[model samples]
Target: VYADNDPIVLVHAQTLLNSSAEGRTAYIRADVNEPDTILRSPGLIETLDLTKPVALSLNALMHFVTDAQDAHGIVRRLMGALPSGSALALSHCTPDFDPQTWQKVTDIYHRAGTPVRFRDKAAVADFFTGLDLIEPGIVVGHRWRPSAEDGGAAGEDGGAAGEDGGAAGEDGPAPSDADVSLWVGVGIKP
Candidate 1:
């Protein structure tokens, strides 16, 4: 299932998914804040079995939702609608590592009218309340379950930037706190 508030994005995603498979894919032009729209979408109902476990992934999407929008509440509501065994996989931007730098980035996003709220580890973890956190709980986006081909500095292969990875340029080595500015995790609803 694919959904987006932008009609164009929904159409585009639908086109791509429809081409790959028929009748197995559905795209809904809806907003995440409105849990009912997504949960009650006829297209989604036809494609996904609501009674079964569903894996909901929200990657780099929550930051776009500000406090005024009650981002956390919206997430909780969405998850509450799913089955007990449903899973939530998410990655959120955080300013815990380098507040100064992340603040600048947040300011830039605000200037562009797309305000981003960089939450700390604790704040991000709050979204997973009542759910059983998977292995590696909430950690830097790159540090969560790193793989051999991982592109971040935490990767066993020395990362994509060739050892001197991360935003600190060579001053601070890879796998540093400041380098990983996003928290990632997966949780299952009890």
Candidate 2:
């Protein structure tokens, strides 16, 4: 099951909801802060088994939630619902590398009425406090298994600079840490 608060996301997700006979897909319009509402969603309950491990992916999402929203608490509550061995795969924007640029970005987001907060490394680490962090711990998004050979962190998506071994400008000179201020990590519930 996929959950997103945006109706537009749900609209886009609708086209991809067609699962093969051997599979299943469900999308719920739910907010991240409201963990209980999301946990009790019919679409989620129908699609996922609470008894089994579930991978909760929150890529490029937490940045939209501000400190006042208790972003870390939301993560804990969501992960708390899953059985042990469940994993949380997350990536968040950070201001550690280029604070001035990120401040401008934050202002832009705020002007547009979207809550935004760029946390430092330690603050981001707090999200995985109770869980066991996987190897590489927290790092720049591209540095996570970055390789030109693997197409990972190689392109605009999240590849290392020039590591993709692609033609000139193919990956666009590799994304700098400041350009892609995203921090990514995975942790398993104990």
Best-performing candidate as measured by TM-score: 2
Candidate 1 lDDT over 1-190, as tens digits, reads: 8889997786689668763445487788899878789989998998888899999999999988888999899999999989999999999988897999998998898889887788998989999999999876887765666544443334442233443233223344446657778888899999
Q: TM-score for every candidate vs. truth?
A: 0.83, 0.87
lDDT of residue 127 for candidate 2: 96
Model 1 weakest 10-residue run by lDDT: 158-167
Clash pairs (backbone) in predicted model 1: none
The TM-score that candidate 1 achieves is 0.83
lDDT of 2 at 66: 84
Global lDDT of model 1: 0.80
lDDT by residue (tens digit), candidate 2, 133-155 = 98677878767766646443344
Backbone clashes, each candidate: 0, 7
